[model samples]
Target: MEFSLPDDNNNLSLTRFESMLKTNNVLFFDSNEFENIIYHYLENGKISLAKKAIKLGLEQHPTSTNLRLFKTEILIIENKLEDADKLLENLHDLEPMNEEIYIQKANVLSKRDDHESAVQTLLIALDLAEVDEGIADLYALIGMEYLFLDQFENAQHYFKKCLEIDNEDYSALYNVIYCYDFLNDNQEAIVFLNDYLNGNPYCEVAWHQLGCQYVIVEDFDKALVAFDFAIISDDTFVGAYLEKGKVLEKKKRYNEAIDNYKITLALDDPTSFALLRIGKCHEKLGNDDLAVQNYYKTVHEDPLLDKGWIAITKFYNKKKNFQKALFYINKAINIDGDNVVYWKLYAQINHRLNFIEEAERGYKKALDLGNYELSTWLARADILIALGEYEASILNLIQTAEFYPETAEIEFRLAGLHFTLHESSKGHYHLKNALLLNTDYQYILEELFPNILKKPSVQQQILNAGKTEN
Candidate 1:
């Protein structure tokens, strides 16, 4: 499609137009130039030119259904959905058998959130013609829509219809898997995906989905095998590698998990999540140095990644390296100052350094931040006891008990405090509870509180207290 501009001598001819279009590739002077014009207008968003080109093309073939589709496409592209619908309506009247026009209208309505109208339009198109491949694809599309809306039954109906039309439709198969998974029908998803893969062994998506379903069902061994097949089928598949690494981690195969993560990073770029997993595997394997190094890689790759810094700080702090732990913990605080874990890590490092004042303030800060979890509060209780603020420790312990009545640690610690202060009755009461909950802890019974074990009167008190509490 080209437009003719006369030469200086006022002569217009095909040879000149062809030479011009060839030189510039604009095709400004061809009889069928409307197609090239519409394409250029669409690619560059030249709406005015697109309209003019549509008009020019209609002059050549006024009943051209393809040109009408082009107009509808341009309108849809410009988000003039109403205009597109109107144009599609005109085309439908001209050619009542154009199933594609109905589909286009359905698409426009679906985009506008009119699912009912979209479904009806497609249904009408299906009624008009049953054995169309396009209708099968439309069924899959409607299934996806219903899936997103959490109408699993409706979605399954459409997806099954698509599979009935074409048993090998991957989109329909995946949709069915998704719908089942959404409904927490992991067993159903497993059966379907397994059957689908048996028929289509080369379906990487089905294998990947089957592995994920296995994980959801807590069948890690089968998950590993599925992901193994998934990765074997496509070595560059990042999703399979990641899931395989997770299965390995669940199986406690830390080395294999790290290897999988390494390959995932090599295929993709180094991600903080992968690095964090690598660090965790090392940490579980008791390679503190490698864990620390990998954690550093994670945080270094994304300086603002909080978990990586947290993992690094905790690993170093647990290893009794206060300085290194402080470095990463402080880095984490700098990244997420409001995070309770970051402040808790800071307090831990300070405790290790015997910086009582700093540790106290750090713990107090964490408490101030509204994280009254038992672990943080218990640490506070211990710190208070160390500082000889026994009253504060007791109060903190009581607060912890309110949140976790089943826990024995809080009561046991409270008993130790009361015993230290020689409050015999209260001490006996708590100690009896500790023993009842866990009689196997002989060290607490013997070494930690020797007086209670030796004194007959105190033993009697413990028995009375246990009887009363029970």
Candidate 2:
């Protein structure tokens, strides 16, 4: 009932010389020529020739998408973007019910920076495209496109329509939930999520997301309720118990979190995340030996788990066993070979143990990987300040100030560095900036400022600013 042409490689005159078109003068030549001419022009850098060929060609087959699409590309290459867009618009009008026409038109609109119109056009095509697999893929494609554009409402509507026909469509469900989260409509998400879970109760991922939503909203009891239903629906769902353990930990129910983690470990694939939580619970309960055991279990189960090594290293670090901390951190580096967070932790521990060159190398590796967030830089500055790399520490703090601008904490550190260098004017400037932001900021007010106060009158000077601040 439908017919289209094969993609012939050569030009029309060349194809006429070929065997297939030898005696088929009636064959619709324009249909197969668009891709060839466009590619030929692009590959050969014959832009003007390509434009001329595509222009005269499409006039003969204006309704042929294959030809119109070719002319559109040629117009784009020629920097006549509006003309290219008008061609797609004309094609859509000529083939208003054609799903491919809608898709092509949407693509042109997207290139023209008209995302809202593109989404509306695709929304209309969604109903038309639902019956055909080609159309369904197109709808899914545009749904995801709108999601990338952060058009949450359109993304949700299109994805929901996609699922109306294909219930098991994973992209639709994933995008719809993403849209809900993006739009901060989690409360609204709950009503329909309950519907998704009713028939598809076995979807552990969906249940976990629902539980997290409840946790984010501070509804711990509901989070526990959701997790309980998740495990009942699928006992082997590792993420459900692991995330439930996190929620329980947030509620300070450390013992109960441990139990949930234990059940998760009983499953076939004991997750490193679960094992790490078990270690943390034991550590919190003051069972260092048990904590160490679970930490090792996590590392052995998945050596690539940086959290596992960090847990063990942190336990030893807190106990002041620097040697053991160093050992475990080294093991972590071997596992997550290029991971900067591991390297940063390793650097901090090395600095604690007075291994200067090793610490420098570790810090350098972390910084080189573009992992120098404010916290990482601040910690690095602490190590530098210890080594009397005074200028380096100050510079690191300055970089950190970029990320934490107008924050009193960073200003206080800047003041500390300037004071240490005996530049009181610069130090006072930063200290004053710190007070302007938060006059009562603990470290700045209590520790740093007290040592620099010329007289007891400075406390009143700062308190007066806090009067109008909050």
Candidate 3:
């Protein structure tokens, strides 16, 4: 809803228009003046005012093409596309060469999910366009239609053409880079950005994009240089400072990273992302107090950001303060209960605190949230076994085997649980599979089923598997 205020000329016209409205005076205005007034209302998101202006303008100048076009635009905005399209068709018959008419037609086609037709209509508009700016706009519109088709290559080509026509079109530049990223061609992006920077050396956006490309290619040295050039081009560029800090962090220069992150804090309001990165840098430097303070600030700035809470929880967990870790992780879960990582952390913290039932529930929630990691499955199954829910443990292991059939860990755990339940045939069957997968993982028997390992038949089977492997 944010928009620019009316300039002095427009302000005079707006004041006159409003005064006329209040006094119920049918004041006269030129078609151009009415257009400016309607545009001002539209720009400020006063759609009803704009519609009223259009009605009044057309009443005074019923043959005004621009006013009628504005009416068509409003109809389109209201999703009365059929009315808009009919109006556009009539307008096209009146002025066949009007680029705006073709553009509006393209808009209607796009809204109807007919993107191919939209692209063709935009091409027609491009042909009618006389000015460089209008041609660039049509190119951008065609690029957008290609994006809706998921044709990144075609989108990239058209967006590149738009950027070539207007080097200052940052959105087109972004779309070109996005297509490159989707295609995983960082090298091409790097080369293209470099060539662009040759002519536009002071363009901060291009430099930032080049830096990002270097980061993707793992060329930290070049990335740092590119970001530094971006900062030189625009000292107020917060993104450059952030990317520079990340590269420094990768190089283990934590002090430099903290300094760069702090610069971002000074340039703008304390962003949660900046605060979080600062905390991580502090933690790396062993400034535990400062790290915890910034972490608190991060969550205070943006309570919905789970990373801040997770950072504090992990910081406490690393210090073996399970109570504090559990406290913070609970806050994180309350903020985003569906996050798989949060639930996994909750399970771990609860398990560490011997809150067995809560740990089991947390693990189950994690699984329900689609955390299919082998470790998550094993931890949940182990908790079930400890709680004497042998059947549940077996069921969990069986499901885990589906996701990771080749893992010796799942087979061995299944063997151990079956043997504990006195299901000797099933236990032996799984044990044989586990040995065939990896005889080196026999230590699982020592840890989880020491009694089963002591059986003469199991020992003889292991010896025979080892000999067969030799």
Candidate 4:
């Protein structure tokens, strides 16, 4: 039971209600007007005010089913499922043919995580609902319940049914495509969307979904065609323009990608993603000044956009301006302190600047934040080795070896560490395994342990290992 105040007098009623509240006058609203006031408070999340309104409404019209249903909705929202269920059961007995009672019951069941029962209850509501009264919303609710249960096929079926009932149900249409994608049935989605487009060729959303499917299958050419049609159908569709730009970027059509990204800016307010993408395309095309300008605009438009900050950081790093890189990366870390990628970049920048201790701390923070990249581990170990912490470096490398079990590079690094620690037997054993795994990594021995490479015993061990391999 959605309450809607008459549009013509709605403002007057609201003004009168506010005036009554200010003056502490008795709120003498009719039942429908009270319902509207209560729903306005509820929709605004002012639960206390909504409760007051409900109390007043029930006092004035104790038999109002709509006020009772609103109370049940509040109970469900507050997670008082047992109370909501009892109220809804009574409402069902009182108004046996009321569609909203079933809908409210379904909502309570959904909050209780009994989504299958929720769907069944909503089906009852569907039967009770008139053809023109919330049928599309009922279908959408059933589809959402099925989605909650991970029954993608059933969800897709109900969402498609919703689309059939209301052609303007774009959310349901998108959900149907989402369910198909979740089931890895892109072919079926593409076929169904194509048929839909035959009847509704100007639907930008359908063309966008088709283009996305083509991209999933790595058919960039077909994706381009679909996106072009999407743009032609609706030139002001910012999403279509942005997606077309992405496909062009993937195909290395930098100038074309830039043009599409520019179009998105022209059609709507500049998005962080669009600004960053434009910067990347310009950078690819050697328009360095333009790239920097757009990258600056990206972070300016949305200060919390971590990708924009990261792009600027990488741009400066590529130019060997470590100071500027560090500045931008720190800004990113400030916004998203737990981001492992930002910590990794921070560590790399500090390492380049010879701030060994700071770099080590940054690496540790990155590892703590779940950075399992092979390079991150290797870099951390290298930093420890540079700081003359042979024992710590060996422990770090050993931990890394657990993640990358059969890597010759790790074995070679371990060999160097052991030899540096004067553990000759452990060094010899690791050297043997290293050469056996990959003899080419023998070159790393000199780079990591220059003194040990000149030792005749080490040279003989390497030669012997090579001979054994032959």
Compare the candidates by lDDT and give the number of the best one.
3
Ten contiguous residues minimizing lDDT sum, candidate 2: 1-10
TM-score for all models, in order of appearance = 0.64, 0.59, 0.91, 0.91
lDDT (Cα atoms) of all candidates against the true structure: 0.78, 0.75, 0.91, 0.89
RMSD for each of the candidates: 8.4, 9.5, 3.0, 2.5
**Tens digit of per-residue lDDT, candidate 2, span 8-76:** 546454354233324644434554555465556667887776665566566566656766766666666
lDDT of 4 by residue, 140-175 (tens): 999999999999999998999888887667899899
- Residue 234, candidate 2: C-alpha displacement in angstroms: 3.4
User: Model 1 misses residue 124 by how many Å?
Assistant: 1.9
User: Against the correct fold, how does model 4 do in TM-score?
Assistant: 0.91
The superposed Cα distance between candidate 3 and the true structure at residue 266, in angstroms, equals 1.1
The TM-score of candidate 3 is 0.91
lDDT of 3: 0.91
Candidate 1 per-residue lDDT over residues 312-416, each given as its tens digit? 777777778899889878877877888887888799789889987678778878988887877788788878877988888888888788888856777678777
Total clashes for model 2: 0
**Candidate 3 lDDT over residue span 198-224, tens digit each:** 999999999999999999999999999
